[model samples]
Target chain A: MTGQSTGQSTRQSTWYSTWYSTWHSAWKEQPLSFKLSSIIVVLVLCFGVINPFISYDPVLDVELSRRDLAPSWEYWMGTDGQGRSVALRLFKGIEAFFFPGLIAGLFAAFVGGVLGALCGYFGGWIGRSLSAVLELIDTLPRMVFLVLICTIFPPSILLISIISSVLFIPSIATIIRRKVEALGAEDYILAHVAHGFHPLKIISYHILWLQCRALLTRQMIFVFSYVLFIETALSYLGDYGVQEPYPSWGNMVAQSRISAVAWPWALPALAIIITIAALLAFGDGIARREEEVKR
Target chain B: MSEQTLVDVQDLVIEFDTPKGRVRVVDGVSFSVSPGEVLGILGESGSGKTMSTQAILGLIGGYPGVMGGQINLNDQGVTYELLKDLPSFISERRGQPEKNERAWRKHRYAQMKKLWGRAITSIFQNPRRSLDPLMTVGQQVKESIQARESHKDALERLNDQAQTEEALEWLAKVQMVDPARVYHSYPHELSGGMCQRAMIAVALACKPSILVADEPTTGLDATVRAQIVHLLQDLIKAEQCAMLYITHDIREMLYLADRVIVMRHGKVLEQVSANDLKEHALERHEYTQVLLDAAGMIGAHDE
Candidate 1:
């Protein structure tokens, strides 16, 4: 038994090694710029998680007297009107902003993608019904819907993300639907069907994987931008992270609105602009690199 | 022609409904193959050679198309009345039955799930389109094996390991040297001939009883096409599997097929044993002679 088990493990490892070697070779063949951009995006996502816990306290700090201090060693990104450190606020904001958006985006993409693929792959009634639903969603004023939902429900970070994600579903579904329709016509799918593969297996194993990487890269950028926009809008309206001790870039900048005549509370606002610009620039770079890899 | 007919199709008719109205693509065609026999269907580009066999395999793509025929598989003693049922209905009959028609339909739908990569397989004309670009040659072949049998034993002790071993064997059988290295390489990395060989390896991995090859060597260079034809012939003989070779190349049909069926305008024009071509020469079916002349096999019996 022991000998057999060891031999089994050896074969399993060999299979894994074979898979790994092929994957690694493909990755290694990618251009240097794509590799570098992918690395940077991964690092930024990691930092978003780690920065709040290890580096700073984004909450529970106040100095009424030192409110709106300029950038200094004491407060690297200076302070908001509430005298909270902008660096700490930015770190925590990253956490609150990224997570809900990522979760919501992934959920929406998965639902919409599967639905779209089914519609495009097995047409006639199924395709028609899905297309009708998608078109109905597309015709709605999504931003207005988000605002109405946010007003009806409590204005928490999670609720806002869900609403924002729901708003983007129709658009994403449309993109995925077109892709699946085109891929359904590809010869590989026909060949698989000719070999008598089940429709479900053809879609899941072949069609889904064929489109997944590109879909993911596109979704990442769209979700990232939309999350930041929604968060900013909510913060400006004094609906999100509104409690005094809690810090969000939107709310921090909103506080400085009255004191535009005073010292640099504008530093937090600058941080918001800088963060958004940086993330968008970084996302674009990553998107370009992904395209380069395909080439 | 029975050495036990492996596949028998009788009175096959395929029609497609278009905006212009219904038009027949394969009108009243019938043929059969004995075990280890190669049956060639020869035609021009729009002659329905591919459609006739696709109907047999129950793989007609949605073109508002309908097929009516009786296909009998001698090994299983099952007769599939293809025209009487929809493609989905025909598919359901592959496996054992369930309690009701609905239940059986579900089972039949599930049958493709179970039978693919095992019972019946196909090789296509374009190797690049047929192969998954992302997968290594070996993994693609292994995927077929892994998909077919659920091996519960330890990986090393699994009986299905023989199937993977057979994939490499089939690759070597197709004259692919360095099968190990080729197995690890992606489809794009290989030449057209090598890709076709890898495809054959996957098709034959499960030792399917019948292999449907649709213009399998159509786009290949002459030498490569000859090699593929020879490889397929040898594999079919050694495995004792029936082959449905669809082609427009009459020379290839004559070289490789044991029996030949010529199709034109969605109908079978003539059926002849490969050995009987010379005797049939005086019976000048004009179209058939034209094909024979085009293939450079016409005799000096008449102008």
Candidate 2:
């Protein structure tokens, strides 16, 4: 009876069955730390991607009458200096942080993937020169550089994301390049070579196919969190980033710069911390899993 | 079975520039295989058997040292000046080598890629490692078949039912019992022998006329090894293809090969028919006699 049922399920599910099994097995195999981090990362990603639809924050809702109120049932986490609901703005703040992070992460991953694969797969003057360029970028002080660039020419949100993404390329590409080098040495790749596969075919099918997904995903998540933190830091510093009249987590906290005892601004600061911590933890888990699978 | 020559390697010399300066790994190695012939290469570690095979396929990287020789595809009437034809990043980095070598290398690689997996294919020494971990045995075989096309043409064509069916047929030809199950399974999911069979299936998928198998059954246990050799022997006969079987096991060569080349110190010492090794072990070259003694084959000279 069970065999018949399994056959029916296999027929009905088709590709989904294999997909689900792979997914389930992967989840089942992860350590507790991986699971916990994955959960935190997933929740943050859900909030980041869907927060716009779920959150209705009036960034321009100036109500001086309700300014500086503490957390209450009606005004969750209280109102900011400009009478903006801190809780509502917190979600919108995530959306602000998230969209930029996503864009920058994607940009970095695309550029990094191509450059790294090419350099590692075809090592010569090309690889060396490209490596030299990456090294130059790598040596830059990311925090100070971004701050200086953004201050010199006040950046729009998109421009800020692009800058962060550009800065991220070196580190991400270094990881990808190292992976291509290591994977190139594996025997399966030699097998592909023996099969008389085109170098491009060997790269795409035999080498990059498995390694790219995990590497890119982990790097993307890391870049996302990195840009989010930098955006917040720049805005909080009052010179660059999302700027005023906007409801980002950083600017909201900056606008609310209150005495520590009152503790209302602490709310936005906490959200930023959780998001960054979750992203790092999630990236770490993926790295660990990648190492394990290589065994 | 046929007199047509398929592959001819002439005076191939491979030198490596190590920390200890230049050293020759394969010195003036020369041999050829006709269609439907099993030509065995017997040698110890570092005998250049594997290197010579790799040199034929341009697997050897251009380095501080160099390779010089010719690997000709007699049937295709194409000659690969194995030395200049393979891409060498090191050569480019070393400054001037007359850009002509690089162009020829690129041109040769492109031309070789056209014939790879179609006219010539290979099975490597390590069976399990030779199969992609993330892919099913079937997918790897199908991809090899697909590689028979132009790169752009391959992208437009995705996995079709016909290719999968053909892949399954190959698995069955390799003596796989449940071809369907094996087709869907990943390399890690199969046993070593099973993976070796799958490797064979993949290499044979495009019906490559010249198959280069480098120690394909080296590490398997006796039973599996015998079966694999038997299966390979049967298939090579059935397909009427030429095979360069590289191994150190003289017994295997005796059983599966028509001609056996004895190698030592990166050079071919003797080329004789397999039957002559048993009947005229001590009567041929000194190296062949040494190999026979090592194999414990008592000859008239042993007394």
For each candidate, the alpha-carbon lDDT, in order, equals: 0.67, 0.76
Q: Every model's DockQ, to 2 decimals?
A: 0.28, 0.35
iRMSD (Å), candidate 2: 6.3
Cα lDDT tens digits for candidate 2, B145-202 = 7775444365665455556656667777888866767777777778999999999988
* Candidate 1 local lDDT, A162-246, one digit each (tens): 7777667777777777878887666666666655555777787676754454565567566765776777777777565434456
Q: Mark the 10 consecutive residues where model 2 chain B has the least summed lDDT.
A: B92-101
The true-versus-predicted C-alpha distance at residue A267 of model 1, in Å, is 5.5
DockQ for candidate 1: 0.28
RMSD of each: 6.1, 4.4
Per-residue lDDT of A1-295 in model 2, one digit per residue for the tens? Answer: 1222212111222346644655566578877766776787777778777776763537567787788888899888888776778777877777777888889999998898888898897777899999999989988998888878887786666777888788889887888899899888777787687677778867765556566766787788888888878878888776477766667877776776653336666888888887777778777666566555544
**Segments of candidate 1 deviating more than 4 angstroms:** A1-40, A51-58, A238-243, A260-295, B1-3, B75-77, B84-119, B150-164, B278-284, B299-303
Q: What TM value does chain B of candidate 2 have? A: 0.87
* Candidate 1 clashes between residue pairs 3 or more apart in a chain or in different chains: B68-B83, B92-B108
